[model samples]
Target: MRNPETILEVDDLRVYYATPQGDVKACDGVSFDLRSGEILGLVGESGSGKSTATGGVLRTIGSPGRIVSGTVTLDGEDILKYDDEKMRQTRWQKLSLIPQGAMNSLNPTMTISDQIADVIETHEGRQPADALRERIMTLFRRVGLPERIYSMYPHELSGGMKQRACIAMSIALDPLVIVADEATSALDVVVQRVVAQTMLKIKRELNVSFIMIGHDMGLMAQVVDRLAVMYSGQLLEIAAVRDMFARPAHPYSEILIESVPTLTERKPMKINEGITHDPRNPPSGCIFRLRCPHAMPVCSESRPDMVEVHPEQLVACHLWKKDENGSYVRQSV
Candidate 1:
């Protein structure tokens, strides 16, 4: 059953990049949802299409890349069908983005306050200077930034502070959904934790939903309510964080979890052993079959649809089948 609080739905999304050889399927048939006030983490190795998928959702893919097919429904409206002006208006008002690098996202010539104020003015029209100042300051306080840094430039603030400032800017209009693309990746461990905590705090206080993209399983474990595993332009699995860590349903998910280093046990890294196929010419069947250890003959003949293997856990793999009791069981190769 779909949650009543579902705020965003991405269905059958396919993003392709143009090349002389052919169209590279960067995000192929990916689907997921973001419920109100929930933090959903999109996790995968590099080139796994995490960023490309989100870029498609945000309608920011540049030339040489395009959304081949998809429906990005936000608040019951298909944002993919929106025009340029409508999307520009919708951005930062209904949906906002906190990019990967805060320093690169911010303007070096403007102060922190001015940058945030510019977003407000551009969207809501001009505001009283005094009221705008107070509003910006309140946003800073909400994100754990100090007032002393309001007049400072991007270079003046530390990496963490700049990220928090970006967070503040993202929420200036109280957008219903925020796509945070590796918002904390460039920070140190301590700062990463701090920024993650700030994001959680914002979620709790403002009832905002988030789609965070990253490669850090540890941080995702700490912050995200659910995890979505992607590989070679396809989503392999999505489940509650606890359910995924305890028993991942897909072979790739299992290998990804095992690849995480633990203090209590040491295991050989199995994530790097598989051979990756060219993006321009992916295999005909399952995209992961080239690297999957449990590859079956059927895996080479057909692509598997996502199936509910357990309560609220969905996986796309050829190794699981429904029994007479209607429960998913591992199929013997």
Candidate 2:
């Protein structure tokens, strides 16, 4: 299939956190493209820079956290260069974020309509009460929230309903790209499924691209068109979701797949026993070398460049040898 138009591009993006000890490279040399209307999943263990990368996209890097380098292009414009005033305009209308713990993001005392109206009015200026209510009602229906709940307080709704409200606010201005930072993680299995379906519907109906940030590979596989695996603040692999499942080019990606419970097949998975990744002081060369079973001497000596192992699949590892054209070729089994 042909690739869709690129809506967002991240090049060598590096975000660091300042602490007493030293700078923690939360997102180091991360790069990827988010195509139009595509749901791209960023999956990794906790503290693997998944959240930080999403922050970089939204330009929401908080105190002590700095985006030291890299360019984040949104709709053909480098958002990193956008002034605060410009960024304020870009947010919600051009790019929006559905923060993690979305249920908690909603104000406790405010009515759902009031919260959503705040976003619309702040960006698009004050509209007639009738027009504003109509717009909010449209968003409510789009996200599957009942019309009656529009004036209800956040506490009046269930966890799932509150999350839907949050989603409604995120899409209040009809953004081109939505960064869902673990949007469905806090809900129960049934509720998670419902929210996922709602998100898919929005994508289909609105033709909006998404950056789905989560650690649940199985859940991500259900909705994401592509997946990017990150570890120790570095991208280990990126590929079509099906391709990553069939043949994970990076050892780290393969191990992650092995850890997933399969419905049809059951086999002993190779566990990386006692291996831990410390972001503050990662390994010498490849960040995953310490845990990788197939680590070679070169893996500890030099960092590996990202190379294409197959069409639309890229892996960064020393196990793969380079060809005459400097393309990555799999080693003999």
Candidate 3:
């Protein structure tokens, strides 16, 4: 069910990759909502399909990967049905990507001004060259970049500066939603903090919705309004950041939060043993059963549906039984 305030709705989204072995279900029946100006942080280990799920939103699934079935609606319009040309027009203007390696995404030969101007020309070509330059300069200032850096090549700027430029470019068209996939993973802690602040500033100023994909739980806690935990191509839990940190519902989510280092809590760290389940041949019942500490016989016998355990929080786990009112009650131990 789509929320009334949702700007982007992903319903039963399934993206698969066809390989010689079999079909790899990169995104299996993922459904979620990105409300207007909401910052939703998607967190999971590598290969958990966090990036693939967001990639589906932009229809950027490359060769061998295809969105098998889904409806990605933006503002009541299903973008999946749009033809190639129509979809091309939606990029940047409606949605944009702050790629994983922002620095590497820039063109080595082109100046920052030229690259940003090119995006403006492609999306809103009616503007004059001076107007485009002015817009670029405004974006540069918005992202905390100086006007002088406009003529500099990507390599000429530092890593953090390059990332800021990427941010400026992403918001150049005033996109409604920005999918920042690992935008701060490569930067130092100080630089990461700065970039994160930059993103928050942009969001507050532009009122742009963000779907940030990263492995940093602490960082996510600081910025995101909600957290979506994924495992083996499936959403395990979704809740407000405060609620999630206070009490995680899913077993996988609990472990993920416990794994992080905290200044207040000093305890012996336990390493995760098994690897993530293979997407091509996931476990029959619950894909996470093999690693879940609280896994019961029922967990291995049937998959659990996502149910509301508390207000504004949903989780998929057999430990909780759903009642008539659609609220989940924990089974007696």
* TM-scores of all predicted structures: 0.97, 0.95, 0.97
lDDT of 3 by residue, 91-146 (tens): 98998999999879999999999999889888877678687888898998899999
The Cα error of candidate 2 at residue 187, in Å, is 1.1
Instruction: Put down candidate 2 lDDT per residue, 1-333, tens digits, no spaces.
Output: 224599999999999999887899989999999899899999998888999988998899998999999999888899999999999999999999888997678888788999899999999888999999999999999999999997899888998988888888888898999999999999998999999999999999999999999989889889999999999789999999999988999988888888888788878766665338556777889988888878888889988998777888988988788789987788753
Question: After superposing candidate 1, which stretches have Cα over 4 Å from the reference?
Answer: 266-271
Q: Candidate 3: which pairs clash?
A: none
Clashes of each: 0, 0, 0
Off by over 4 Å in 2: 1-4, 264-270, 273-275, 324-327
lDDT of each: 0.93, 0.89, 0.91
List where candidate 3 sits over 4 angstroms from the true fold. Answer: 274-276, 323-326
Among residues 3 or more apart in sequence or in different chains, the pairs in candidate 2 whose N, CA or C atoms overlap within 3 Å are none
RMSD of each: 1.2, 2.0, 1.4
